[model samples]
Target chain A: MNLAQLQQAFRRWLVNASDESAQLLGSNHVGLAVYQNNYRAQLVGCLEQAFPNLRRWLGEQAFLAASITHIDNHPPHAWTLDAYPEGFHATLKDVFPQNPDVHELAWIESALNEAFVAADAQPLALEALAELDWDTAVLQLTPSLRCHDLTTNAEAIWSALWQETCAPEAVMLEQAGGLLVWRRQFTSRLRQVDALELQAVQQVQADGSFAGLCEFLVQRLGEDAGVMQAGEYLAAWLGSELIVGVRDV
Target chain B: MSTSNPHFSGYGLGLRKEHYCDFLETSVPVDFVEVISENFMVAGGQPRHILRQVRERYPVALHGVSMSIGTAEGLDTDYLRRLKSLVDEIEPLFVSDHLSWSRSGGFNAHDLLPVPYTDEALDRVCANIHQAQDVLGRTMLFENPSSYLAFEGACMTEWEFITAMARRTGCELLLDVNNVFVSASNHGFDALAFLDGIPAERVRQVHLAGHSQGRDILIDSHDSPVCTGVWELYARAMQRLGPVATMIERDDEIPPLAELLQELSMARTLGAAL
Candidate 1:
């Protein structure tokens, strides 16, 4: 057989590992299921690693069934299987339209992955602020700090799951929400944020001065809203490593 | 940590994630390290970060498992770009991939699949290797893979296929001794004859690893320690081929670095004694 024919045969044998393929293996089709089982299991495991939140929400049985079917349709295009789940959330959205949170959860998972492997840079030191002209300086995030604006509390659900908090249901208190997925020391951490807080973070990220950000939020939320209470908020953000780098706009 | 010298320390193991903690915690005298090119290509997480740190400490060899050298479609440009980016960052001692093909029609099987032995295949593989070398800006080494089955229309032996590839492209051979043994046992061919077919001067590096046996054939698992028979084959090949840079590749069932170093040290001893 030519190289293409042989590879095509092998591909047929692989997908139909659990089931059977039509004359793909020539004469020796027996015991191929064992190899097929192992291949499918490993691929599924890779997806689980990529989308732990999806896997948790779907559970093992449902996750495996859905994932195996997905792989059958879209076998990995790259040698790196880690990148396969990049668009899985959209796929799940198509499969389960009623559950928008499931699809949103996939976005959170993909965002967290980007945060984990994002480029390493020097996070802003507490002392750097003292050096910066606070009036003119813009507070930029770590550049690796990622936040996906979603329509449900999927981030909170994902965060809870990471903390081993049960209740994998669609009982989101907040309907319109965003997720904060960022690398805090050695690992990725996720949390849910409101639309106002999401905009506040983005303001800082988009080269808006911290004072300007506070003014923008106050304009949106009202004077009574203490969104600019920098003492507690900055302390919390710095402690959580939710910000990185400082530059002048 | 020195980026000035591109040469790796000579003896290193495949940097797998399961052994990352062990590698960081303990400091062995391993000369350099080899990384699976596709593993960290676009992958992030702890593995990618740790890979950067490891690159700081040791020279790395970017070894790939799925270049699909023998594919009928020939080289894939997109995959080559990713590999080139990795080489630019890691600055590895050498960039090598399997002589086997793991992809066809863009369906990446993600396995070190075997290729049929035909003049058509040999020419395609040689052309692909030359193209790879041109893109990578260095000579590449091709590793022989363990086979579970063989193609019925093979025109030449596996060894002849390999040597002819080298002759066709001016590329080097990796000469995976364990794969020779595994494929030989599976197809009932003389492993020594397979080794003899390759040109010795073209051998830039050698790979000595372990294999697992099945009810009917052997699998190049790279999980266990190098078996007695494979080691014997390695020694026999080294005696004739002379010493070459060798690494221990264990993707599954990875043990302690010290344990692998023990096997690596033995290779050093064998390569030097030759």
Candidate 2:
């Protein structure tokens, strides 16, 4: 085989380890076995490292089974191994279809991993907010911020697992909320927010106007409480360093 | 071929996360620290932050694992751009990857897969190297990788291909002694001939790593201390390539900083002897 053809064959051997691809390469079986072993082991190790909390949550055998299934279905296409773990939540969902908690926990780990390495941005200083007109001002969130609708008590489980404490049993929340992950300075932070705050953040993210957020909240809550909640969320987000930029639109 | 990279002689260690506190908080007695370029190639956060702090203390080298220069298709421009941005920032002592392919046909294996030493493979590798060098605006170094399999090839030896590659592209060489020993043992080639064959002047850096013995092959695992056989080869290598920048590369089952420093001192003593 030529260079491209040879590489394609090698890829097949690594991804599938089929007998045909091995024979086509015409290399030693012992050598090919070594390559195959290395390929799978490296990928397994990547998943294990990326989702340590997920591994703990699922227990060892179940996690390994899920990881193997993921590997079989999805051969990595990215240059960095960090990108490999981004799609693992889908695998978790497929494996544990009934367990929303597993999926949320996977999402938490993936979001935290992404946020840890996400682009650096300076949080908008509170002094900068003094000059902005609320009607026309646009607020920019940190690039590292990630959000997802959370239906289970995955946050508690994650925190407990992280602290090496006995984790509480997973249960569906009476009122579903949202999970927000972002980095503050050099540390990645996670917070569980109520549905109203989630909607407000989503509103600002969609339109970035303080007035638009107030309007959206006003329709949800009454005018007085809506505007008050907007102001409170702004203060909390700013204090948490989620607001990174402000611009006059 | 004349290389743009200048020669430096010193001993260092691969800066892994296990010893980040040791390197950042205290003064580690090493000439330079080598970091995996891909690890710090992210957009931001603590990885970059810690690297910045470490860069302030020691001259760092950017050792990458994902370049995949031997891929038949071409180079990855996005990878090159990120690496160039890092190079511009860190001004690393050397930027290097392996003479192996981990990516091809848009599927990345993330392991240092072997490349056949054929004319076609050589041409693709040289072209890829030229592209990478052009994009980075610096001469790159390519290291010899450990291999479990040798292809049914028509053309050249590993060192011969490397010599021609360096001659064609004017790129420098990162002589990995442990890889040489491992591949030699696995493929039943003369390690000394492989060592003597490469152009010494083109070699700018040396890597001394540990390997594990597999069922029938020696695996370049890089998990333990340098074995006696590999150390002896490194001593022989020092005699030929005098005063090259050498470092002890340990990747897994990492020992304490003191243990690594002690291993590095052995390299220092050998260099001093030379």
Candidate 3:
């Protein structure tokens, strides 16, 4: 066989040792176990790294079984293991249909990792924001910022696990809300945001104009109340270094 | 075994993340430090920050595992571009990858898979190496892989492939001695014969790592200190290719910096004795 044909056969055998391509792997069938083991073990280890808290919640045996299933279904298409675990959240949902919080926990953890290395940009100075015309100024968020709307109490469990405290029991919260994850300096930070704040942040992110943000707030509340709410959110975002820039729209 | 590349000569260690602060805080006695290229290929993060600081203190060697040099689809220009960007920043003393392929079709397996030693495989790998050299504007070093199985195809041996690749592409070789020992034990080939087959002049660096003893094969786990047998083989390698840069690799279960330094000191002592 040629190089391409041999590689194709090897890849096929990796997924399934009983494949017809096994003929090309030579008569030493036992040796094929090494390649198969490495492939599965490396991928499973990647999933574990991507979702440590989830692993603790699900227990090692269950986590490993689910991760193996995920590997069999979605062998990484990316060059680095860093990009391989994005599909694990979907896999967790599939395996734990009754426990939806597992999916949310895995996603929040993955988002934290993504936020840590997404990109680097200077946060807009709070003093500089006062000089801009609020109506025309377009506010930009830090490149490392990520927001997610979650329905489960996964945020509480994730926080406790991250802090090495006694993790609270996973449960569905009465009210659904959103979480904002962003990098401050070198560390990644996340917190739960109220429903109204989530909507306002989403609007500012989409349109990026303070005037539009004010309008979004006004639609949610009255004119005076909306303007005050916008000011409070802006203060929080600035303090968190989530807002990166402001310029004329 | 008459000629040897005189560029780099000293003991070194693989720069793992656990030892980044150790590297930045104090001056380790090693001459150079080798880093896995993929680990630092990020936009902005602590890995990049630590690497920049380490680069200022030590000569860095960019050893990559995802080059997939033996892939039939061809080299990934995007991956190469990122590698070149890093190379431009660090100005690594040497850049290298394995002789094995890591990707097939669109999916990347990430682990280094062994390549069959045949004229067809040789032609493809040589071409890939040539392309890599052209893109990076520097000579590339290809390391020998640890193998678990030999193919059914009747062809040349691994060292013959390495020799031919170096001659054709003008690329240097990273003679991984532990891999040679592991493959020789598993495939029933003479490890010394494998070493003698390669042209010593093309050897630019040597890798020394530990392996796990399995029931039927030795796995290149790189989680322990160098074994007596591998170290003996490394001594033989040093006798053949004098003054080659060497490093101790520990990918898993990495011990304290002092422990690795002790092993590296052995390399220095043994190389000096030779």
Q: Which candidate is the best by lDDT?
A: 2
Per-residue lDDT of model 1, residues B1-274, tens digit only: 1111132226678888877776677776777788888777763456667788998887778888778898878788988888888888887777788878767787777776667788878877877887888887777778888777666678898888888887777777777888888888887899988877789777767787888766676766787999989888988998877756778888778887778888888888877776
**Candidate 1 lDDT tens digits, A84-133:** 78867766876787887788878888877777776665656888877677
lDDT of each: 0.75, 0.93, 0.88
Model 2 local distance difference test score: 0.93
lDDT (Cα, 0-100) at A8 in candidate 3: 83
Cα displacement (Å) at residue A71, model 1: 1.5
Q: What tens-digit string does per-residue lDDT give for candidate 2 at B1-274?
A: 2248878897899999999999989999999999999999999999999999999999899999999999998988899999999999999999999999988888999999999999999899999999999889899999999998888864999999999999999999999999999999999999999989999999999999999989999999989999999999999999999999999999999999999999999999999997
Once fitted onto the true fold, the runs of candidate 1 whose alpha carbons sit more than 4 angstroms away are A5-9, A16-39, A52-58, A94-105, A125-143, A149-170, A202-219, A223-249, B1-10, B43-49, B265-274
TM-scores of chain A across the candidates, in order, are: 0.77, 0.98, 0.96
TM-score of chain B of each: 0.91, 0.98, 0.97
Better of 1 and 3 by DockQ: 3
> Candidate 2: which stretches are off by over 4 Å?
B1-3
Candidate 3 per-residue lDDT over residues B1-274, each given as its tens digit: 1122247887899999889888999989999999999988888866788899999999999999999999998998889998989998998988999999988898788989988888888999988988888888888889999999888674898988899999988899999999999999998999999999999988889999999987688899999899999999999999999989999999999999999999998899889997
Which order, best to worst by TM-score?
2, 3, 1
The DockQ figures for the candidates are 0.37, 0.89, 0.72
